[model samples]
Every structure is written in structure tokens, then in C-alpha cells.
Target: MSSGKEPANGTSGTVRRRTSTRSVTLRDVAAHAGVSSQTVSRVLRIPDEVAPHTRARVEEAIRECGYVPNLAARNLASNRSKIVATVIPSLSASVFSETLTGLSDVLAPEGYQLLLGYTDYDDEREEALIRSLVGRRPDGIVMTGAVHRETIVAMLRTARIPVVETWDWTDTPLDVLVGFSNERAMYEMVCQLHGAGYRRPCFVGSLPAGDHRARRRLAGFRRAAAEHWPGREPRVVDASGHPLTLESGARLLDVARGAHPEADVLVFSTDIFANGALLAAARRGLRVPEDIAVTGFGDFELSRMLHPGLTTVALPNATIGREAATLLLRRMRGERPTTRTIDLGFEIRRRGSA
Candidate 1:
């Protein structure tokens, strides 16, 4: 038979534990603060309107109970989400990280939250993310690039929210544009290298499919190379895919070396790739700027610190993010900007590597 003695209190047999599974509500906070629910709500929404003592009590109760306001409900009631959605290619790149940080720094001060999404350079994924972000009813949306699928463009038009596209420029943008022309920038970069007497240049970059920015750069590179070095076909190597990592860069460099060993100047789509090519050249016992000249786009910090310092196109990553946020914030406040496009141009950093 079972021992029928009910566990006595403090007898080390059994203890009754009360665990409240219910979520803390406004009424509970009001009860804890010894105030009406409306007073608690006022304290949360408009603290200055509530008496100082009441507000303090409500705040204390909130802290004690770890109360978190339902943002969705609040947003519905206010008809303002106070959220900005940003979609970029990849967070693995430091440029995108810097952009995000710049956006957060500006938006956080204005009581707005940033929701981030990564597309990994896929148009379909970008469209999906845009759809999801639109469903959240964000106050504004910031897209990384201007190039989007037709469906994405149509959705953006239908959503009717303030949109800012960065990283690349176009004559026509979805809404506000805050970026330099990748094509022109790369074209000018090629001119710079050519002017510096580095002939026989080759463009090494990812496959021209989802990455429209890289394709634009390649187009610029090809045009510049054809005009500068006639009769010699442009040595374009599709290192292929989103090879943003150093290992991928190194492997691509190996491919480039085997294909175009005569290339004196190698223009990479990214600094990470250039850095990898630099290491690959070192491993092959080749001297930088002597045996080969290395250059890259997006002057990452490593590009500056590397031995023989990588020559690269220095893009204003942080500025793009900050400007995009500023534009969105202006629109969020019911202010129309004088200009829809802001071309924050780039510069070519010439170093020993080139």
C-alpha cells in the first residue's frame, strides 16, 4: 500500500511550489502598482502625463514582474510599427556589417528598431525577404542593391513604403537611392591602374548571375580594358558563385593563375579575394608588383594592413547605411526629400601592391 501521510510542510517529504504560467498583463501590473490599468498604460505610453509617484510605482512593478509590452498590439493600436527593415546580400562581409551598424546608430536614437535580413545574393530570396518584411508593416525598408526581380519591384510599388536602395546606383531607383555607381567606379579604377602603366589586366570575380554589382564592375572593367588595351581580349575569369571567403578567393586565384599566367595586373571583385590572391602569389614564390600587381574592390581593413598594402576601390559603406537611414527617417516623419538619389562616390587607393 502507499504511505498515506500527506507531506508535512518543512518536513523534507514534499513541498508545494506555486509556478505562475500566465503571462504578465497590464491588469497585473496595475494591481502590483496599486493603480488603475489606464494609469499603468498612461505611465507606459506617456510617462510625463502620469503623476511622478504613480509612474515610479508602475515602473517598479514592471521591473519586478519583468513585463514586456506586446509590440504587435501596440503597433496595431498606434498604426505605426516604428520598425525599419533592412535586407542585404550577406553579413559575412564586413562592408555589410558596417552598413548595419551605421543604420542602427541612427535609428536607435529615434526610438526605431531595425530588422535585418540576409539574401546571400539571391534575387528569389531577396523577394521572399521583402515579402516577409512587408507583412510586418514596417515604417520603412532599406534594400542593399537596386537590382531586384520584377515581382520584388512590383511588391515594393504596392507596399507604398519609403524604400532606400544602396550599394549600387541606377538612373531609375525603386524609391530613394544612396550609393555610387559600381560600374563607373570600377571603370575609373581600371583607368587608374592603366594610367599607372600596369598593362595586361584581368578581371577576377564571382559569376555574373545573382551578383549584379559584380557584373556591373566586370562590364566596367571590360570596357576600360578594351579601350585601354586594344587587340588583346579582356581576360575575364568567372571565379564563380558567392566566393566571399578567403579560401574561395585562394582557390579562384589558383584557377586564374593557370588560365591567365601572363596577366600582370589582377583586379579582384573584393578585398578578401585580393588578399587570398596575395597569399597564393606568396606561396608560388611570386613577388607582388614585380611578378604581378594585385588590386581589389572594397578597401577592407585587411587590405590596408596587408604587406605591400592592397590597392582597392574604397567604398563609403558606413556613409551609404547612414544616408539610407536618414532618408528613410525623413520619409517616416512625413517629409519628402528634395532629391531621390544621392551618389556617394568612391575612390581608388593606390598602394605598393599595384
Candidate 2:
């Protein structure tokens, strides 16, 4: 029998001494810097409190020892997580990606980090995400869209934290608004198409059960079409079975054309779907803008690169994200904006596709 402290024998009976690999702590950095633990804390927390030479020495020691501060303990002491929670429909989409990039650009410099969640455009999932995020006690919260369940709205209201509702315009914002009018934008899109001599235009998109914004846009288009082109029945295709993809767009356009053979133009809810529709038409030996005109929402990168250059509505995705982050930062710092609603409107880009 060997003592626990004795060197262990290897496979060949060669003696070997074990070494411990413990993480370097604050005390280690302090010892290496020849300073007290309090001084080391001050250097990290408020470098201005320490002399320039002392701060430099402590920083060098920290690097030499690879010392890392315990953020958990620090957060407990400061009562701040320095985290901003954001919940969006989906990150796979460029709209949300752009916004997230904008938020990170502004928040990173201020020592704030983003905690993200996806709701898959479901109200119940969003409610669950909200509950989970609120439980984390983040410094602020940013949510996409104005439409939320009553329980979600009530929970956010009761939390008393700064909340920002983005990507849609609403008079009764949960806290702050950093978005545009989806209804007005779609209405204007329909009017734009109608102005260009498209009398029989049909709307194609997913069902209302998943996307409330799409439903609102569809309503706006219907209202505008009724007012502008009365006596002509509007055509709508329920493409809700599949995810909002180019393939779905292609399939839905085929169905819409079949239902309304006289339809001269197709207005898609998104550019990806419109691209699919364009491909489908091309496959059927149809000439774009001559045989049938097509338009889409969200002027994403793919829209610009398309053969005919798709005519779509350009949204300020990154700008919305940056503005939302700025507003949250201001609110966190005890500053209030003169107005909470910041409407960054959309623009209709005319292209060969329409």
C-alpha cells in the first residue's frame, strides 16, 4: 500500500508526480502585482481610483497570471447582470439578424451583453420565453412586434423594467416603440402597384394563425384594393401549411394563378417567396413584367441580385435594432425620451420585376 501523497507509478512502474491545475484568482493577481486584494479589486472595478503606474502594474500581473474575475460574484455585489434580453420571431431571417447586429454594435462598447431567444412566431412560445427571460432579471428587455398575449403584456408591465416593442407601429406600446407601420406600408405597396396599371393583383402569404403582421398587411392590401379597384374580386391564397420559403412561395403562386387566371400581378409577403414565384413563372415559359408582374416585401440582398431586380419594400432592420438598443440604454441610465414612438418608415423600390 502506498500513501495518498506519494508519487504514483506509471504503466512501466516509473514514478510520476501529479500536478494540480487550479484557476488563477484575484488573490493570485494581487500577490503577483505586490498589491493588496482591495487594490486589485479597485483596479478592475474603477481604474481611475488607482494611480496610472499602479494600474499598469496590476494589469500586467493579471495578464501574467491569466486571472479572471468572477462575474457571478461581481454581479451579485453590483445588483446588475449587465445583460439585455431580446426575443424575436426567428434569427434565421435576415431582418432579425440585421437588427441583432445593430444592437450588438451599440451595446458591446457599454459593457452590456445580449441574451437572445426565438419564439418561432408563436404567441404561446413568446409568453414562455418572456417568463424565462424575466426570471433571469436582465437589465432590459427587447421584444419583436406589438401583438402579444394579455398575460405577456401584463407580466412585462408588472416587471417595471424598460421594455421595447420593435418591428411594428402601435399607439399602445408595452413600453417603447422602435418600428414602422406594417399596415400602412402594405397599403401603400398595393397603391403603388395599382398606380402602375395593375388592376387585378393578388396577395400571397402564410396564414394568420402564425404571422399576425402578415395578416395585417393582407388586410391593408384588401382594404386598398377594394377602395381602388372596386367590383373586381381580390384573390388570396392560404399558403400556411409550409414554412415561409422560396419553395412555398412558388407553390402558393401556382395555386393563386390557378384560382385567378386573370390575375395580372402577384404581391408576395416576402422577397424569398417572390423569388420562388418568379422562378416558377420562368419555368412555365412566362416573361416577367410582360406576362405577369410580381412584387415582394422585404428588399433583402437576394432581391437586388435577382435577374429582373425584384421590386420590394425596403425595411430599416439594422436601424431599428440600433435605435432600440439606444433607447434601452438611455432608460437604464435614468433618462427618458421625449417621445417613445420612433417610426422609421419603409420605402417602395421600383424594379424590373414589377
Runs off by more than 4 Å, candidate 2 = 1-22, 48-57
- Per-residue lDDT of model 2, residues 110-177, tens digit only: 98999999988888898999999999989999988899899998998898889988988899898899
How far does residue 171 in candidate 1 sit from its true spot (Å)?
Answer: 1.7
Residue-by-residue lDDT tens digits, candidate 1, 153-254: 999899899999999999899988999999998999999988999888889998646789999999899889889987778998887764578887778777
Scored by lDDT, the top model is 1
The collision pairs in model 1 are none
**TM-score of every prediction relative to native:** 0.89, 0.89
lDDT of each: 0.87, 0.86
Candidate 1 TM-score to native: 0.89
